[model samples]
Target: MNASTFTTRFRAAMMPTVPSPLAMLSHGKGARVWDVEGTEYLDFLGGIAVNALGHAHPVFTRAVSAQAERLAHISNYFASEPELALAERLTRLTGGDAVYFTNSGTEAIEAAVKLARRTGRPRILSLTGSFHGRTMGALSLTGKPVLQDPFRPLLPGVEQIAPTIAALEKALADDVAALVVEPIQGEAGVVDLPDGYLAAARELTSRHGALLILDEIQTGIGRTGDWFVYQAEGVLPPGAAPDAVALAKGLGGGFPIGALVGFGAAAQLLQPGQHGSTYGGNPLATAVAGAVLAEIEDAGLVANAALRGAELRAAIAGMASPLVAELSGRGLLIGVVLTRPVAKEIVAAAQERGLIVNAAAESRVRLAPPLIIGDAEVAEFTEKFAAALAAVAASTPTGATA
Candidate 1:
């Protein structure tokens, strides 16, 4: 069926929780996708940073198929080889001692919430401009009110503070269980934390006897040119590591998977019968994630993400457009700040020009293209993005600000 027919069916059958369909995508390969009508577009958004290897990667395909044929689901009662291997890999990558798998990023956050609760402390602290997830526990920890207001009476003992050392120092105490933070706040216009903020947070949280959890759902799995942002140089001081980390998005590439890795004493937070998931660590999902991570390592895509990201940033800056305010974020994750609140307009213009991007906020356009993108993808992106910016600038009135 055509995209229009699917759209009609979608609106009729689906709940109104989210907006109507943009386009009914048919298939994708690498960083490009096609609609039902066979129109192609460059997928700069990369499924909101979930498609680390892009769509339909050979490694992903082979892993899923082969694993399905061998062993798909054995439940938590029986341990699988893939599950154990993936767990070992994740713990090693994050320098953690243990792992708990889940089905999505929010689930990982939920697990983290439980871990914090196990500390026997009264409160959990997050930043004001943070976005953790939408589940009750994760949503409660999320700083934005718009997303949390509807679901009032959310999990108690959760509070938010400004993303600064001063704010954290004032808010933290012996009563606080954990402080959850993102290395780079993806949902908040891809905002980065202040320099040395993580290190200082580590010191303060340690002194206060609180767990410092890093939510790397969007920034982990080589998205920021490192296995995880905490491992990135200058992000955290030497020998400093988060007590626990929440991971998802790119972990299974395009597949659905999430994990919580805990370090030191935090690793033993969840005792038996405290929490469980029916399909959390299934063999199929673990096998796919294991393959995806391995391919990312073998292909040196982490280095590619770092190099290509730098090149893309340079090229965008070279445009020197009056509308361009500045660039935020690092590696494949990028945010284009505009002088005016025309991010939605820019997104529409780019879509019309056969490119895909996301308006992270009123004045910010986010780009998270596939990690495998090379010079060709970067060139195409800059050309189309330049045109889109020009189109928006031409349409907007002067002296506009947001």
Candidate 2:
């Protein structure tokens, strides 16, 4: 069917919770995707940063096929080799003692919530402008009121504080169970926390005996040039570590998977009967995720992410578009600040010019191309994005603000 036909069908059948599909994508390769009508576009959003290895990489394909033929699901009642191996790999990467598998980032946050509750504390804290997830527990932790207002009466004792050391210091106490934060606020226009804020958080949480949970769902799996942003240099103080972490997004490289890694004491919080998932840790998902992570490590994609990210940022800055304000974020996760609140217009223009990106906010454009992106992809993106910026700048009125 044509893209328009599919869009109509999608809107008719789908709930109103989310907007209709932008286009009916047929397939993708490396860092590009094609719509059903055969229009090709450079994909910088990378399925919202879930397509770590890009679309249909040979490694991902082979692993899925092989694992499907061997085994897919055996339920949590029985263990599998892939499941065990992935668990071990995750622990090693995060320096955590245990892992709890889930189907999405929000589920991972829910697991973290239960862990905090296990501490017998009454309060759980999350930073303002943080986006955890959409589930009840996660939504409660999310600081955006627009998302939480409809789902009122959220999980109690969850409060949002400004992303500052002083705010955290004021909120943290013996009654506080955990403080959840994102290294870079992806939803809040890819905003970065204050310098040494994480180190200070670690010290303060430790003093109050509260768990410091890093929500690295969007930044994990080498998206930000490291396995997790917490591992990035200068993020945490020397010899300091978070009590737990929530991971997803790029973890399965486009497949659905999430995990909560608990370190040291936090590892023992969730008892066996406390949490479980029928599809969690299944062979197929875990096997595919294992393959994705393996390819990322073996191919040196982590280092590639670091290198490519810097190059991409330079290319964008070199354009010197008047509408371009500045850039934020590290590695492949980038945010382009615009002089005007024309991000949506830029996205539409870019899509028309065979490029795909998204607006993180009214004035901020988010770019999350695959780690495998190289010179050709960057050049293509630069050309199309420049055209997009020009198109929007021509149409937007002066002094536009969101």
Alpha-carbon RMSD of each model: 0.9, 1.0
lDDT of 1 by residue, 200-305 (tens): 8999999999999999999999998888888988878799899999999999998899999999999999999999999999999999999999999999999999
Q: How close is every model to the real structure, measured as TM-score?
A: 0.99, 0.98
Going through the candidates in order, what is the number of backbone clashes in each? 0, 0
Worst 10 residues of 1 by lDDT: 1-10
Off by over 4 Å in 2: none
Best-matching candidate per lDDT:
1
Clashing pairs in 2: none
Candidate lDDT scores, in order, read: 0.93, 0.92
Q: Count steric clashes of candidate 1.
A: 0
Candidate 2: lDDT of 264?
A: 97
lDDT of 1: 0.93
